[model samples]
Target: MQKTVLNEDHRRSGARMVDFGGWEMPLHYGSQIEEHHAVRRDAGMFDVSHMCVVDITGLDSAAFLRRLIANNIDRLQVAGKALYSAMLNEAGGVIDDLIVYYLDESNYRLVINAGTAAKDLRWMAGRLADWQLAATITQRREGAGALAMIAVQGPNARQKVWQALPDCRSACESLQPFFAARCGDLFIARTGYTGEDGYEITLPAEQASELWTALADTGVQPCGLGARDTLRLEAGMNLYGQDMDENISPLDAGLAWTVDLVAPRDFVGKAALVTRPQQQQFLGLLLKDRGVLRAHQKVVTSQGAGEITSGSFSPTMQQSIALARLPLAAAIGDTVEVAIRDKLLAARVVKPCFVRKGSILV
Candidate 1:
């Protein structure tokens, strides 16, 4: 398994290590629940260096990205504006969900998921070749000038980050959400997966360890994948492999908002999405009875049978919640039954978001 630059730090901190997408990552330092609470009540940091960073640059960069992603990149007129988009296959299934940063007319940065780096690169290379576009795709995940990412998240996440890197505070303090500002060697983006107000800092690889130590010294708790999963699930964010995958359409995966079909621009899978139609409605489920929701569990609804794509006991809500793809006929206030251990448990349907910004939405 590949180890990140912070592997030794995690070991020194007594983090329980586990294999995740062929990379050895920290499951937790000692208590996953404590780490979860830390993010909600205060601040926490994650060593997300395993993720892939791809840079696209050339005279045709804008044109290339316009055809590559489902979301229209034309909206990104200002430098440092970021867009969350899905790259799809020709059949409308999601190849991967990523964030694109518009640095200039000729350069864009994409941060893709850790597991799909190779596949994403192959697809992008093939597409670029087929289009005969004059764009250069460079992987910044290894060797010289490699970048490392650290996600500091929670209500006090930004302040703690400022405490560590005081130089970045002035430049990034006023940045809006989904926007990024280049602070010297740091690319501080007001973005995170934990559904909290924070920044995902990308900097040179060798500087990651020092920053991690600095954040820790500033009372930022070190969280692991265990807390990260529950936090994102509570925030109603989709996990790539669990909630959506290569075989899953973004529309059915609760990501229709990310797809921009109203724009005049053409993307990779617009035709298929227009023709395929959305078969399922992705929504949230709150367990009304005693049972924990898990993925792949059968859902019995009045409209039709559905399934849980991702579920967990929300630490913030103190109840079992889930994100499921049910029939379009299933309304938000409807009650449904979930199959668990050969027994049916009652659950309430609600919006996909269960929590955001330390507030309960459902």
Candidate 2:
């Protein structure tokens, strides 16, 4: 298994390690709930080095990406602007949903899910070869190869990071959301999966340990995958394989906004998307009664039956929450029953369930 540059740091901090997508990563420091609250209230840093960082450069980079991703890259006009998009197969199924950074006209960067890194790269390369497009694609998959990523998130996330890395003040202080900049060796992106104001920093892997220590000194708690999962779930972010996959279209995953159908250009899955009738819908569920929600639990509604895709006890909401896939006939404010263990628990269907930063999306 691969180990990140901060592996020793995590070990020294009493992290319980686990194998995640072939990477030995910290699952939790001590308590997952404590880490989750730290991120929600103050600041917490996550070692996201397991995620794949790929650089796409060449004369045809912009044109290449326009055809490759579902979203309109033209929307990213600024140099450091970032786009959230999905790479679809010919069947209109999502291969992966990724964040693409428009570094320049001739260069772009993609942050992809860790588990699908190898397959994603090969898929892109194969498509590029078939299109007869010439673009240089490089993958930074392992230690010191090129870059490492760290996500610092929460209400006070930005303030804490600025205190630790003062040199980034000029470039990041006034940065807008979804914007990024390269400050010396640090590539700071004002983005995160958690619904918080923070940055995702990409830097040389060798420098990751020291940077983690500096952030720790600034009272930033080191978080792990366990806390990240609950936080993202409460924030209404989708997990790649659980919430979506190659067998499912983004439309059913509540990611239709990421698809661009009026670009005046056809992408790989455009025809399939156009012809398919909307069948399933993704939604949030709040357990009204007792019992924790979990993946693969059966959901019985008045309309029909559905399945919970991603479900957990929400640390923030203090209740069991879930993202479920069901028939489109399932309406909001409907009551449903989730089969947990040997009992049926009551739950309420809602839109998104929760949103951070004072947005009551539910």
Candidate 3:
């Protein structure tokens, strides 16, 4: 199994390790619930080096991305600006959800999921060939060089991160959300998956351990994938394979806002998306009774039956919540029954986000 630069550090800190996307990653340091609460109340850091970072460079970079992804790349006019989009097949199914950073006119960076990295690269290469564009894709994982990524998140996340790298304070302190900036070799982005104020920093692998130590010295709690999952679920963020996959379209995956259908520009999935009627609607559920929600549980509604794509006990809300895709008739405020084991539990339909920046929304 592949291991990140911080694998040894995780072991030294007594983290419970698990296999995730072919990488031996930390599931939790000790208590997953405590880690989740730490991120919600204060600062927490996560080792995310398993994610793939690809650099796209060439004269036609912008043109190539415009036709490759569902979101309009033309919106990324400023340097260091980032756009969240889905790379789709011709049938409008989501291949992967990614964040593309516009570094310059001829250069852009994409962060893709670890499990889908190989397939995404292959798909991108074929698209480059089919379009006959001059753009080039370089996977950063190749060669002797290694890259380490870390996400420090929550209310105090940015403060602790700045304390660790004081020299980068000015460069990244004023960065707006969804934007990135470079301080020497360190690429700092004011972005995160936990729906909290934080930075996702990418630097040379050799420097990762030292940085992780420095951040820990600043009292930033080390979090694991388990807490990260609960945090993202509470934030209403979608997981790639669980919420949507090659068989699901962005329109039905609570990602319609990310898809640009009004623009006249044609993209890879434009034809299919325009022709296909949206069959399912993705929404959130709040269980009224006591029980843990889990994926694949049957959801019964007055309209029809649906299945939970992602579900968990929300640490911040202290309740079981989930993201479910049901028929269009399942509207907000509607009551539904979830089949948990032999019991059918009642739940209320609500908007996807349960919390944001530590505040309860629903």
Candidate 4:
């Protein structure tokens, strides 16, 4: 099994480890609920070094990415600005969801999910060859394993992160959301998965342990994957394999806003997306009756049957919340029946996002 730079630190802190995407990662550090609350109420840090960071450079980088992903890369005009996009196949199926950072006219950086890193890299290479693009792709940690990534999230997240990296305060203090900046060897991005204001920092692997200790000294709770899952679910963020995959299109994955269909620019999946009918609708569900919701549970609606893509007990709301893929006719106020075990439980359809920046939306 693979391990990140902070694996030993997690073990020392008594974290329960589990295999995730072939990497042994911390599932929780006693009380997953408390960790979830920590991120919602205060500050919490997560070791996210398992994620892949790839740098693309060359004169054709910008043009290459514009044709590669569904979102319009032309929107990223400012350096350090980031754009969230889905790399789709020719059939309009999502290959992976990623965040691309605009570094310069000829350079860009992409952060892809750990599980899909290899496949995504291979697909990117094939596309480059097919298009005859002159972009060069470099996987950051392919050889020396020199990179480490960490995410600090929640209300007090930025404050504690600044305290931990005092020297970087000036460089990133004015950094806006969905933007990034480099301070010394640290690359700090004001982005997160939990719908909270925070930073995702990438630095040298050798300095990761020291940085982790410094952040802990600032009273930032160390969190694990279990809390991360619940937090993202509450925030209505989609998990790559669960909410979407090679078989699902962005239009049906609660990611239609990220797809640029109006722009005249042609992308990889444009033809198929324009031709394919959007039969499925992705929406949020709030269980009206008792019992927790889970993925793959059958959802019955007046229009048609659907399935929950992701579900969990929302720590902030203290209720079961889920993202379900239903028929196009499923409205916001419509009632649905979820088959949980032997019983059919009633649930109400709502917007996917339940919380944002610690504020309960629904």
Candidate 5:
């Protein structure tokens, strides 16, 4: 397995290493539940260097991105603004979900999933070649220009990050959500997957350890992938491969809101989406019976059968909750049966989001 820059540090801190997308990353330092609670109640950090960061530039950069992403890039009129979008295939299948930071008309930054980084790069290259665009793609994952990313999240995340890096406070203190600011060599974005207020800091690879140490010294707990998964699940965020993939349409994956179909602008999969109507309604399910919901579990609804896309024991809710792709006829208030083991368990349909900013929505 490939090791990130913090692999040694994670080992030193007694992190239980696990293979995630070919990279040996920490599953947890000690108690996974405790780490999950720490993020919900206090400040916690994660090493996200395994994810890929690509910089797009050149004269046709804006045009290339407008045609590339499902979300309209024209909304990013101001610098430092970021947009959450899905890059879809010609068939409207979701290629990947990413956060694009708009720096200027000629430059933008994309943070993509680690598991699909290689494939995403190849796909983007192919599209560029076909379009003959003048945009240049530069990946900041390795070599001299390598960058290490750290996500500081939770309610007190910003304050702790400010305490650790005092110089960045003034610039990023007023930074709104879904925005980014470049402070010296640091590219700080006010974006997080854990449904909380925080910043995703990207800095030179060599300076990563020092920064992590500083943040840890400031009482920021180091979290791992185990906590990361539960947090994102509770926040109603999608996992690239589990929740949706190349064969899954964004419309069916609860990501239709991210697609800009209203705009006149054309995109890769706009035609397909226009021709085909919504097939399923993506929603949340809360287990009423004492059982845990898992992915691929069959959901028996009034209209027809569906399946759980992402399910787990929500730390904040203390119940088994899931995100499922159900039939359009399934209403939010309806009760459904899920096949757990040998018996069918009861689950209530609700909004996909169960938790946000420490508030229990469900």
Candidate 6:
């Protein structure tokens, strides 16, 4: 399995390591609940270096991206503006969801899910070739302007970040949400997956360890994938392989907002999405009984049955929560039963649940 620059740091901190998408990463340091609270109250750091960062630069970069992603890249006009999009196959199924950073008219940076790196590259390369566009994938080598991504997330996340790196204040203080700035050798983006106000800083790998140590000194807890998963799930964010995959369309994944079927431009999956009928719909499930929800659990609704795509014990809500693909007839405030171990438990179907900054949004 591959290791990141923080492999030793994670090991030293006594983190429980697990194989995530072929990368040996920290699952948790000790108590996942504690880590979850740390992010809600104070600040927490996550090593997101496992994610793939691809750079697209050419005279046709804008046109290439418009054709590549389902969302319209034209929405991203200002420098450092970021747009979240889903890359789709020709069948209108999702390939992966990614954040595209509009660095300039000729250059754009994309951060994609770790599990889809190779396939995403191959797919993009093939698409670029057909468009006669020049494309290159930036590799994170031992010595280069590589990005060692650290996501500092929480309600107080931005405050802690400014305190840790004073030099970044000038550029980041007035930055709008979902915007990024190039701070010397570091690029600080006001973005994160944990549904908090924070920065995902990408800097030289060699210089990252010291910055991480500094963040730690400032009482920013070192969170692992365990907490990260729960946080994102609480935020109603979709996990690539679980919530949506190559077999699912973004429209059915509750991510139709990310798809741009209009705007007079053709994307890879536009044709199929327009012509197809959406069968399943994504939703949030809150367990009304004392039980835990897990992936692949059968969701029984009065309309029919669906399946739990991603489910977990929500630390913040102190209840079991889940994201499931249910029938469109299933409405909010409906009562549903999820199949647990040997028994069925009742759950409430609500709008996609979110717990941000220590408060649950119901």
Candidate 5's residue-wise lDDT over 54-74, tens digit each? 999999999999999999999
The number of clashing residue pairs in each candidate reads 0, 0, 0, 0, 0, 0
TM-score of each: 0.99, 0.97, 0.99, 0.99, 0.99, 0.97
Residue-by-residue lDDT tens digits, candidate 1, 1-362? 99999999999999999999999999999999999999999999999999999999999999999999999899999999999999999999999999999999999999999999999999999999999999999999898989999999999999999999998899999999999999999999999999899999999999999999999999999999999999999998999999999899999998998999998899998999999989999999999998899999999998999999999988889999999999999999999999999999999999988889889998
The number of residue pairs in model 6 that clash at the backbone is: 0
What digit string (tens of lDDT, one per residue) describes model 6 on residues 1-362?
98888889999899999999999999999988899889988889999988877888888889899899999999988999999999999999999999999999899999998888889989988898898876555545334666688999988888888889988899998989899999898889999988777899988788878888889888899999999999999999999999999989899999999988768999998999999967888999999999889989999999999999999998888888999999999999999999998888999998886686678886
Off by over 4 Å in 4: none
Error of 1 at 73 (Å): 0.3
Model 4, 1-362: lDDT tens digits are 99998999999999999999999999999989999999999999999999999999999999999999999999999999999999999999999999999999899999999999999999999999999989998887556746889999989999998899999999888999999999989999999998889999999899999999999999999999999999999899999999999999999998998999999999999999999957699999999999999999999999989999999888889899999999999999898999999999999999999999989998
The lDDT of each candidate is 0.95, 0.90, 0.94, 0.94, 0.94, 0.89
Candidate closer to the true structure by lDDT (higher is better), 4 or 6 = 4
Cα lDDT tens digits for candidate 2, 1-362: 98887899999999999999889999999999999888888899999998999999999888889888999999988888999999999999999999999988889999999989999999999988988877888997564466889999988888888888999878888889999998899999999977878999999998899889999999999999999998888888899999999998888888899999987988888888899946788999999998899989999988899999999998878889999998899989999999999999999999874758524366
Best by lDDT: 1
lDDT of 3 by residue, 5-55 (tens): 899999999999999989999999999999998888999999999999999
Collision pairs in model 3: none
lDDT, candidate 2, residue 117?
A: 93
Which regions of candidate 1 are displaced past 4 Å?
none
lDDT of 1: 0.95
lDDT of 1 at 59: 95
